[model samples]
Target: MEGFLYQASIYLAAAVIAVPIAARLGLGSVLGYLMAGILIGPAFGLVGQETADLQHFAEFGVVMMLFLIGLELEPRALWDMRHRLLGLGGMQVALTTLVIMGGVMAMGHQWSVGLAIGLIFALSSTAIVLQTLSEKGLMQTKGGRSAFSVLLTQDIAVIPMLALLPLLAMPGGLSSRVNEATDHSDPGLINTAAAHGDTGMSLVDGLPGWGVTLVTLAAVGAIILTGIYLTRPVFRYIHVARLREMYTALALLIVCGISFVMYLVGLSPALGAFLAGVVLANSEFRHELESDIEPFKGLLLGLFFITVGAGINFGLLFGQPFLILGLALAVIVMKGAVLYVLGLVFQLRGRNLWLFTLSLAQAGEFGFVLISFSRQQNVVPGDMTEILLLIVAMSMMITPLLFILYDFLSRRIKDADEALEPDDVDEQARIIIVGIGRFGQIINRFVRSSGYETVVLDHNLAAIQRMRQFGVKGFFGDPTRPEMLHAAGLKDARVLVAALDDPDAAVRLVTFARRERPDLHIIARARDRTQVFRLYQAGANDIVREMFDSSLRAGRYVVENMGLTEFEASELQRTFYQHDRHSVRELAALWDPDMPTVENQEYIARARELEAELETMLLSQLEDSSDSDSDRKSA
Candidate 1:
């Protein structure tokens, strides 16, 4: 227990120290975790053999993560990705395997060895890729989604790869070491099951292929059925206990039980968990489940990444530095080439194409399982297995750098190719709207519907094209560019709307426009009170807080539900809005751009005073209305 506490302390301490620094430096948390692992395990020797075992346990994080991801995706959404999953994902595995295999064969290895190596390298790290994509907020992009489809396909392909591995086992190829280690553990996460010793359970053991298939099918069926029919009642039962901990326990029970079943049946536990999540995607309790599982998933995933760094066979790597480094780079380059072409073939362009290519270039965590399994199956030589392990770890370690590079390239890509010039504005309108995002779109429609000519300009080519489909004429260009603004007729425009999604960009545009055309009536969209002050300071005639109006409507709705008439509620809302707007203009004068709001005593005192005044005025109005109503009734 003492030893365990020490180990935990070391890991937690390392994370606390490293992660924030990495985040500050823009290196991402994953890389920080990896670096921490390397420090504690390899460089400092604070951790040792337990690293491999810990990694296996940490891999549960991946299962939990898949469950969460599945919760986000309905069956219909998963079905919609069928084409990319089959076409893009399937081809990537096949082509990458064949290419890597051929390369291995060229290096004087036998066909079986080459094929084993190929299968191992074909897969990318789903945990790392998905986590990184999510962190960077790129998971919803065309490239990120495509990458996810391929990762999902690779996971499914692991089953077939495992089945085919033993078939390639050479006659008398088993080394004594391998013979001693053959325990038929599940794929990935090292020899976790074997390390823990046999549980004496036999669901798929010694079964014929058909029998195993039936068992697999039945297990999957049970998960789906449980999700659809059983989870609700189970949750409701747990809810009766009125313990927040019970919900967490139940969520864990669902994941762990499904994982154990999958392990017993020789299937991917992560895949089973994912399947269960998809089944429950539309459940009323989905959000509750997500909230319960999210913390565990995050911690475990972080531990898993740390273990990966700790488990690196640095001795082997240093012994053959060039050979290992060369192999790792080769895998990344070969896979990158395949993904790039696939991206092009599938119509991925600009930043997205580069994103898709760079993100999946590294060998994944699953490679560890395949490499170890191959050794037990005698498909890969012992010496080659160590090299492959090093290569996989090194590649996984390099993934974050690839993501950083993608960030760099994405900035340069700017949504369109450099060769694609901006659309020329042949005509000008009285009203010019910059950035045709949600905010500007409504204004454009309203102005146009009222028989007013308006010019729309946006940086997103896709958004512009989509708007054009709705018969809204929007030119594709960076609205912040001085030349673009001039072409859009900012000089003669009566009203200039800076409704950009980016607060900084909107402020900059407003500042530039105001300076260029002082007479131009510039209305700017602000994300928050801070932005409102910034935009007001930038000389925007009217600064619209994005959520203020919606929030007021919601507040009015609440008041209406609380026994107030709609008219009275609306009057209250109107009074609040007017007071709020006037207070904003007053506070903008006191807002110090150089100082934090909490530190500004004048601003705080004035804000408090305004709040008190508004409350008193609202109470006075309500009292007057009540008195008038009473008088009329008495009359």
Candidate 2:
């Protein structure tokens, strides 16, 4: 127990120390976790030996992460992405698998071994790519969405891979040796069945292959049904108890139960969790479940990456440095080449195509699972397993560096493009709107209704067409392009309103407009506090958060519902809005995207203190008004 505690302390300390430093360096938290694992495990020899044990425990994080991802994806959204999922995602996997299989076979491996290895290597890390894209605010970009679609397909593809792996086991191969290699006392249901024989302890046990398949399908169907029918009632009962802890526990219980059922039927537990999440996607409890599980998922995923870093066999790497490094590089180059071609074929160009290529050029976390499972089935040699694991780890480690390179290259390209001549300003308008989406449309309506000459520009052809049908003239072009901004009459426009959906693009436009036309007043729409800070840095004259006004109105309604007069609620809301706007500017000045986590936390604490001070001042003013009212009544 003492040793266990000591190990825990070391792992915790490594994460606590490394993650913040990584974030501060702008390399991101995933890299920090990997670095932490490397530093503690390989470099200092502090936690290297314990990595194997920790790996199994950390894999649950992957399972939980899948569940949260599922919660975010509704069935309708999945349907909408079917083309990209099948075309971009499916083709990438099939092509990559065949190419990798041929390569492995060229090295004198058997067909089965080649196929298994190829399939495993085809997958890219969902955790790393998604987290990186989201953190850098690229998720909404064309490349980011394409990457997401492909990753989702890969996740679903894991189901068949799990089933296919067992069949790929070589006849008369080292099955016994493989079992011995993977032997663990608590190896879970599937491993237990494989080792000790099917005991028929569960209903599906002792079933024929076809029977087991049917049972597996039935189990998945049952999960979907339960999610659709039973979850809401169960959650309602839990919510009635009003115990947040209980709600969290129940959320975990549901995920665990679904995962266990899938495991018993010899399926991917992550797939089962994902299916359950999709079923509950539209449920009111979806957000609640996500909130409850996110922290656990994040911590476990961090541990998982750390273990991946720690588990790297440096001795093997040093012994065959060229072979291992060559293999990893080969895999990345091949996958990246395939993704880039696919991106071009799909009409992606410039920054988007590069992002798609670089984002998914590495072996994913699932590669570890497949390699381990293949070794257990004697499909791959034990020595090969270690080599493959190292390769996967090395590939994952380089993913962040690829993204950093992409950023650097993209900025240089952007800088070069800045010299391009602006488009001819044919029709000068007093007001210019960058985005004619929902927010910009409303603003355009009000501005034009008041008799102002407004020129609107939008990149979305469909949006432009729709606006034209409604008698709104919106030019179709990229608002971030200097030429497009000039064509939209930025020079002559007194006020420029940027209401673009892409926060990064909005920031870029703001920065460019500020630099080019400093006299023009820029009103930018921010999605949240982070965007607010970014836009302020970009020199927006006024930043209006997308939901701030609606939220204030909601607060006023709440105050009125609590028996306050409508006028009083309105006045209170006005005061709060004014104070909040002031606070936003003051607080934004302290916010730095590249700041260390510790400093960011300290800033948050200080902001909370300021909020308390504001509340106290407001209360004192209310008390003084009450006292004055009472004295006037007595007089």
Q: For model 2, where is the 10-residue window of minimal lDDT?
A: 186-195
Q: What is the C-alpha lDDT of each candidate?
A: 0.88, 0.84
Off by over 4 Å in 1: 173-178, 182-189, 192-199, 415-420, 480-492, 511-519
Best of the candidates, lDDT? 1
Q: Output the lDDT of residue 562, model 2.
A: 85
lDDT of 2 by residue, 510-587 (tens): 999999998999999999988998999999999998898999899889978987677667767877888888788888
Instruction: State the lDDT of candidate 1 residue by residue for 403-431, as single tens digits.
Output: 99998888777644534788998779889
RMSD of each: 2.7, 6.6
